[model samples]
Target chain A: MLLGVNHKTAPVEIRERLAFSNDPGVPYRELKAIPGCEEFTFLSTCNRVEVLFVSSKGDETERKVRDFLFAGSMSYDEAGKYVYLYKGEEAIQHLFRVGASLDSMVVGEPQILGQLKDAYRTSSDQSCTGVILNRLLHKAFSVAKRVRTETAIGSSAVSISYAAVELAKKIFGNLKGKRAMLAGAGEMAELAAQHLLNQGIAEVVVANRTFERAVNLARCFNGKPLAFEELVPELAHVDILISSTGAPDLILHKEDVKPIMKKRRNRPLFLIDIAVPRDLDSKLNDLDNVYLYGIDDLNNVIDINKSERDKEAVRAERIVTEEVLKFMLWLGSMEVTPTIVALREQAQEICRDEISRTLANCKDLSPKDQKSIEKMASAISNKLMHHPILFLKGEDAPEDQRRKLAIFRKMFSLDSVSRQDNGESD
Target chain B: MGDLLFKGTFLLYLLSTIIYSVFFFSQNKTVRKTARMFLLGAGIFHTIYLIFRYFEAGHTPLTSNHDIVSFFSWAMAWGFLSFRWRYQIKNFGSFVSILITLQLIVAAMSSSEVRELQPELQNILFPIHASIIITAIAFLAMAFCGAIMYLLQERELKSKRFGFFFSRLPSLDALDTLNHHCLSIGFPLLTLGMITGLIWSKQVFGSFWSWDPKETYSLITWLLYAAILHQRFTVGWRGRRIAFFTIIGFVVSLITFWVPSYHFTGL
Candidate 1:
């Protein structure tokens, strides 16, 4: 059983109250007493609060889990309006979709996969998840990987920082040995700086009007701090320049950049001015090898990327359906696999018993003749079992197949033997 | 056999032109690679055709307009391919292959019939002068293509709407650098070709500086390239300004090849 409140159904205000604590001990203890809940795990993220559990009571599990989540905060009837419940195959499909990021607000975003893995790890550490969930979550991870490779969902940039990295790629072609200069320590600039660093930029230069602030920002990024007056000379050494100074007058003008183009020997320079009043003059855009994008330009590119991702999301949804079907088929075969294994073991046991009886009665006969007779008996047993095994595994319609399996199990008394196999420890 | 090979080269270039245009408009990497392969095939056939024509003509096959045009087309294809390999600018071929196809078609249309050699054109230096000038034009052709791409990419960047042109064209720096590199390569070649022609004229016409129309136009083309290079190095004139002049220089060189020949009885 799976009970959850996602962005689609719940307001963030309520979600924040019911959201699970990062420490699993609180939620594990809280959910432990839910009647008939044999095992369980809690998944809480900014966009969702989901409780997945193994329960015998089916529909009642949803009520118990929801009541526990909103225990003293709200009444059952009030919280019920925000929660969605699923059971059996529906619950499995929901988990798969969430793990694959198909259910994310920004569909195909990669963060959800990591979050799901973190939840799985926490549940495993708490020993709250048993065999069924262990297999399901591992399978979900593989399905997510397949979705990532088989679709173009994660290839395009859909955020401001990602768009900045993409634009840098468009200008520099590669970022392996490039340098980035950050003119100010605005929040957006810091985010873009981190992205550039992740892309393998060799060094970073931080420049600001306030010397101590620049030094602080530089220390945070582990970059070199440049005096504000050294901005012109520093421009020659960097391939990417992001200016977000909050100055009324332009921090960068055409004349300041024009000479840098020559000193840089025509190497490309990508300028991103993300300041509110615009840190760089518009005229600086006309410089020969300098590519400049103001705040609106980056936002426009991000918008385009978002629309492109929305288109690819449709294709990603189809992949999810195909993967879910594959998982379901494998699950169906799981029940049959154990039954077939037990039946084969029972038949081989009967053949061995009869062969030993014949050998004891024929003790006066030659030893070689006794061995040949034993081999013959084993061959006959295998040939006799092959037909029944093939019939059991054949692709008949689901309803007819279930009826056939029941009759076959009863006629052969395989159910009693399977029950004994299960009771071995008992 | 010569005519058949020439036609084959012409048709192959036309096919590659279509392929490159498709690659440019669609911006698909697979189509770009396929177009590059088709171009390589065409270039191979073109080389074979040139060798065959050289054997048939008995001379160097650089004197007549038909041979000059064919040689020019081959040089453009070779130069573009080399640049594409070195720089990995696959989409730039869309504009350049079209230019190559047009040049080949003009070559196919011109008379390939071997005319009796004019007495003044029979010197060994005639082939040298023609070969250098044609090769110089090939380099200038690359510069010309780079200029057009620079303008288009600049327009897209300044407008702040990145569309097909923005995605397909190489960066502004790449195009500008290509223009500068081509000019550096072509200027020296042009100067050497003029020097060879000066020596040839002194031997045949008894005057190194003849006021012939061909001589005057070659001088004008040279001066234009020299000015472009000088401004680029000293005054830091680049990007759109340099691209515009490189394009103009290529057109004037074309005239120096075709128009001046009509003015002279034979040179």
Candidate 2:
């Protein structure tokens, strides 16, 4: 049973209360106690909260999770219309689509993909993802990659880092000679710097714990390398501050940046905190001209980009579907291959058996003659396999033979196993 | 040995064009594959033609507009091959085949009036100008495809006409990125070509600033392309609007390329 409310269903107020991440195993532990719940996963985001579980009693399991999430806060009836439910293959397809990021709030948003994988991994660690869900998740990832490579779906991610630079460009007209400072030189910080430099940012300052590594990284981007202690001093001069550091402690305390903020005399400062534990102080957002953006705040820009991406997505989808269908048809034809092999082996066994029997009766036959008969029998098998092998391979197949091969898959249990996967997984 | 193969290849482009048209209508994967293989084969044969023609002429292939166009189309197909391996864009082979075939037709028509290489103009810098310019145009062709796709995708969006292809196409982000990438790579190349062309003219003609039809048009085309690139990256213009400007730029290039040639007046 897959049950939840997202931006598609519930309002933001309900979604926020019900939103529960399972990284700490809190929701997973609580969910396992529900009656008839054999396996479960908790999917939580700013816009949606979903509970995917395996249960014969799908309705009861969904209700229990729904109630557990809300915890006697609001009436179930008020939330009922917003929440959705899916069971069996539909549930499988939903989860796969979600994993593929196709059903994401922002179509082709990549965060949900990593998040979904983490959720699946967490649930699997807790022994919640059964065969069905495991297969579904894996297939979803493959489809996501297919959508990425095959179709130009995610060809350009249009990430928040990109949008941040775009916003800066709108403010400054051009990035040439613009001063940019990176608080932490992590992936997001690097990406933001790269985006800035691509627009011709004149001077970029990298501030990190190890100044040597920072210097090395700065050289790659042709930027300045500054010590971590130099951050506040350098912050007053820089135009953009993107904080993405791995330190557990708060690197930029509110007071620490407040002095620099005042020293700049109301100069516009864009602070984007993409780090997981958030390097910048959130209170700094209240300050004037200090445009601070967290992961959630990026949704607005991401949504705009998504809408734009959604427009050109039409042709990409056509190309993807055509490729997907082509790939599926080719993949589906793989079932009869084993049968084709088996049949050839069966024919060869019969020939070998008969040849040995004949050899036993002719005791006067030399070893060389016996070996010749064996070779002849094997040759017969090889010759007979030639056509079927080619047919199975889509090689010069007569129209009817191709049709027969398709039929052969049906005759065997080819799709029964794969159809359960709904063509999402490998 | 190479002559028969080259002639067969020139004929093969005619057939390849028809095959590509069939694939466009049918959308048959097999037909598409056939068109791709055939185009690749034709490109190989055309390459042989150019190489042998270079030997036969006892000079480089960029002797006239005819050689430049043919050689440009060849390099363009090679560019497509490089992109096709990574991008795998559907129906591109069809589009590329039509483009290359049109170029081939124009080149073949002009092939009858081949001129011997002028001694003063036979420096390596001239070929550098020709090579960079042709390769830059190939990148422009890529941008052209991206623009076409952008318009089609935008029209589909405005119309809300979601169909089988509605989901398969590259997103606006992809198209815009592709367009920008082409401009970024092509712009420098175009600049280098222009600079080399100027140097070559100074060496051969003893003046860099003569407003020859080719020179004037090339500069005009370059400026237009430059404007589009500037607007896209700096002005944040994208999607349908950028598509219009990109095509406009390419048209300016084509006119500057084909219209002023002696083919129109001499014929």
Interface RMSD, all models, one decimal each?
A: 3.2, 13.3
State each model's TM-score restricted to chain B.
0.95, 0.86
Instruction: Give residue B267's error in model 2 in angstroms.
Output: 14
Cα error of candidate 2 at position B125, Å: 3.2
**Where does candidate 2 stray beyond 4 Å?**
A1-426, B1-3, B14-31, B163-168, B259-267
Off by over 4 Å in 1: A1-144, A209-213, A265-267, A313-426, B28-34, B84-87, B230-238, B259-263
- How large a fraction of the reference contact set does each model reproduce? 0.23, 0.00
Which candidate has the top score in DockQ? 1
Candidate 2 reaches a DockQ of: 0.02
Candidate 2 per-residue lDDT, tens place, A189-210, comes to 6667766775678888888789
lDDT of each: 0.80, 0.70
DockQ of each: 0.17, 0.02
Give candidate 2's error at residue A45 in angstroms: 12
Candidate 2 chain A: 10-residue stretch with minimal lDDT: A395-404
DockQ of 1: 0.17
Q: Could you say which candidate leads in TM-score?
A: 1
A261: Cα error in model 1, Å: 3.8
lDDT of 1 by residue, A1-426 (tens): 789898789865677687665565788877877776766778887678898887767667677788888877999888889998888778888988898888875556677898889888987887777655776788778778877887777777756777888778766667888999999776578768866786788888899889887886786568999999999889999999988888888888899988888887666678999998888988877777678898889898888778777777777777667666755654453455766886778778988899888878878888899888878887887898889889888997543455567667667776664345323211
